[model samples]
Target: MNDDMTHEPSDTTGPRRLTRTRDGRMITGVCSGAAAYFNVDPTLVRIGAAVVTILTSGAGILLYAAAVLLIPEEGKDVSIAQELINKQTSRN
Candidate 1:
């Protein structure tokens, strides 16, 4: 005489924000940033970009350049040395 089991649906999270990575950058950080945003390997993104560039006759280069100029870098992780540098510069 026990029948009472109700379950609520799980909430889904949205996609990760796309931003250029400061640490994982190779050239302009576009591929690494995209990899982080899409939750994939950076090499995959690089290879895909290369394939697109080949197939589209260099359009991918333009797109990548645009992304470099438009996308903002991920949250800046300030280091102790950087903090000290900022402090010293501010005093001068």
Candidate 2:
């Protein structure tokens, strides 16, 4: 008769994806998206990126740029090649 016993466990095997946040974003929501995906604070991710950028002579900038291009905005569909093909097929 315990409520906790009646509750089902959440799915832990779901696909983990990174996408830009619609809110709590600064530049392009890269850091915020990463933080949300990783369950960390956005500030921490930003600080880590800053430190990495400083220590790695701008490598962080390149990584950030790649993330911006690759990570889709939240509430938007992922348009990677497979998805694109699926979309094209579904519309037919």
Candidate 3:
């Protein structure tokens, strides 16, 4: 009848966080971060991104940019876009 016993054990490595990796980054680490989150190869992600960008007539570029703004970098808490919004709101 113990609550702790009822709950499942948590992952020792902690929950998988999607953050931009500085080591394997080519641009802003968007593709690499996404690859890590999805457990895929970084090269595959990059190629897929390129193909999508081309097929979408450049819409994928915007998506990549948005991801860069939204996804936090490795070892950082807030995303770039969040920080910018916070600064803007504070100034107003």
Q: Which one is best on lDDT?
A: 3
RMSD of 2: 7.9
Better of 1 and 2 by TM-score: 2
| 2 or 3, greater by lDDT | 3
Reference-based TM-score of each model: 0.63, 0.68, 0.80
lDDT of 1: 0.71
What is the Cα-based lDDT of residue 45 in candidate 3?
90
Error of 3 at 57 (Å): 0.7
Candidate number achieving the greatest TM-score relative to the actual structure: 3
**Candidate 3 worst ten-residue window by lDDT:** 3-12
Error of 2 at 68 (Å): 0.4
Q: How do the residues 1-92 of candidate 2 rate in per-residue lDDT, one tens digit apiece?
A: 65432222133476766778767799988888888778777888999999999999999999988787678877666734446677899999
Q: Predictions ranked by lDDT, top down?
A: 3, 2, 1
Model 1 TM-score relative to the real fold: 0.63
- At residue 51, what lDDT does model 2 achieve? 99
Clash statistics: count for each candidate: 0, 0, 0
lDDT tens string, model 3, 1-92?
A: 65422322123378777888776799998887787777677888999999999999999999998899999998888999889999999999
